[model samples]
Target: MLSYVRWYWPEEDRWNYDELDTDRWSLRHVELRGDGEVLAAASLAEALAARDSGGGGAVVTYERRFGVVPEAPFPPPDGDIEPVLETLSAGEFEQLWRHARNQLERAGSS
Candidate 1:
């Protein structure tokens, strides 16, 4: 499972939840594996810092699980992977930040 953090700016009154326009939103993906975990922690820390800086935007996090489809003839079936999103309270965000920061420090020492 890969964690993704995104910050949507300008705070729109209404949003089109049907689709994601990555070109306009600030996005970060964290891979929680091996050396990638260290980089992932750093990425999460960056997003947390931006959120804490009074950036006046909405910060959201989600987990994505990639799927593997069987090899098919020509036109393979669509293997759409939907992200699992969670709405976190302020305290939850703080806890996540603490955990990620700890991992980052541990990795740095190693």
Candidate 2:
């Protein structure tokens, strides 16, 4: 089955949750092994033009990784926080993408 993985910055929540907000999230298409390990992954933009290689139907996982920033004098330190992951069904993924795309088009025209 095909799966989608999204990595986003939780700090960006200050801005409303815009699904198509490229600044907030990065998306990829992933293939998993039978044991649930990631077999391979590709950027969504690359996968969109290609056909599904077929493993499992699309399962979408959103991961939020939080980081801590130091005060002005110091540069933003880089560290990993335990990621929060959520999985959504293919149908829900399609709906969210469709809505976001429509919103983007409307915004562009305006």
Candidate 3:
């Protein structure tokens, strides 16, 4: 139910998060725009957090894009994901990131 919404506008042709190279976790809800505007957005963390609201908020663990660990917990809503994501080994999570980067770079460079 959570998403790290990403978009690229061909005019500038850049990914349009508040910060580039900075991973984002939507606190409440946010709007993402591209082409003209309004691509997609939602209450990412809330949805994730809401799923396991009982105790410390359980994490649906998954390996990082290139991680050494079997599962990295989805970060708590208040915490940063980058630290946890750092556990990923170089080029370990390359499959997804490379594919997306290729697509976006191709799109942006065009």
Candidate 4:
């Protein structure tokens, strides 16, 4: 199981979630979704710091089981992945998404 921290950005009406293995605090996955599109990070703190650097002022809600975020439609990402910044170009985003998915699948089987 994994632990995660969820953040809500009221200004953009979006949410970003990050997961890390509780024992080692190793970042496993990240998701940033707004209006249904997901942009998915680094370490938990590093990820949040990166976001904060962007000036969004997101508020931390709570930490809980990675896959059990209330009201979120999709299950948490499998370990061994990180999301690209939302500002990435379409082509870059596609490449990053594919890489992340491949990593996730590999992690699951190991």
Candidate 5:
């Protein structure tokens, strides 16, 4: 099982429970609710890096904690996303999510 996490808006300088998706072997989907608004959805690894990159000014960093994370279930992302980041489109995000699940299943030993 994967965990859901919330992130803050970097450029807008606002705090929102923005979400991210990570390669958790088995895709983990977290729907963030703001009173009742849907912010951007990102990966867990990106979120964490975005949080740290907040100080860079103007361009907020996207996708952090990647490339060296432990390879098991994967840890939750902090709140960062792609630079000049916008939420992933439904079709696009789902496609990636499905791919992650496929990888996890294939990696599993019968």
Candidate 6:
């Protein structure tokens, strides 16, 4: 299980990782603040590299661990989950999300 790890802090809207917009990996492990902290050698190396490159907030060596254990080899769910939604295209789901987001934003701004 080797993978790229990233951390996200919602309160601060900060991410302790490289620019995700430019990162090529579609599947990744994104650890949030609630996941808890951990200190790994790879995370330490990244912090060290950041400091060497003159980046701020790079001295911190701790990383957030997802603590997630997915099914071995990752299989689909055992039962039907909104079979109608499953039949829809990915773009339709995205559009639904966009609409919901817009509604929430408008409500918040009201």
**Best model number under lDDT:** 4
Clash numbers, per candidate: 0, 4, 3, 2, 15, 0
| lDDT by residue for model 6 (1-110), tens | 22232334456553322111122222222222344332111223444465687555444322222212222221224633312211223444344334433543454467
> What's the TM-score of every candidate structure?
0.33, 0.39, 0.23, 0.29, 0.27, 0.25
RMSD to the true structure for each prediction, in A, is 15.3, 15.9, 15.7, 15.1, 14.6, 13.9
> Alpha carbon lDDT of residue 89, candidate 1?
46
lDDT of 5 by residue, 1-110 (tens): 22333334455543322223354332334322334322233354544455566744312433221112222332325524522334545555565445543543444433
Instruction: Encode model 4's per-residue lDDT on 1-110: one tens digit a residue.
Output: 55444556555666655443545243534445566444343234543554466534331321221212232222335524333323334445345445544554454467
The local lDDT score (0 to 100) that residue 20 gets in candidate 2 is 27
Best by the TM-score measure: 2
* TM-score-superior candidate, 1 or 3: 1
Per-candidate Cα lDDT values, in order, are: 0.33, 0.34, 0.32, 0.42, 0.37, 0.32
- Return the candidate ranking by lDDT, descending: 4, 5, 2, 1, 6, 3
> Where in model 5 is the C-alpha error above 4 Å?
1-84
Model 3 spans with C-alpha error above 4 angstroms: 1-74, 77-92
lDDT of 2 by residue, 1-110 (tens): 44433333356322111122223233433322334333233344433323244222221221111111111211123545533444556665556555544543454467
Give the alpha carbon lDDT tens digit for every residue of 1-110 in model 3: 22333334444543332111234332322123333332222233434554467433333221111111111223435544332222323343333344444444454466
- 5 or 6: which has the higher lDDT? 5
Query: Which residue pairs does candidate 6 place in steric collision?
Result: none
In model 3, what are the clashing residue pairs, if there are any?
65-93, 66-92, 66-93
Tens-digit lDDT track of model 1 for 26-86: 1222223332232333233344454576352522321111111112211123535333344
Worst 10 residues of 1 by lDDT: 62-71
> Candidate 3: worst 10 consecutive residues by lDDT?
62-71
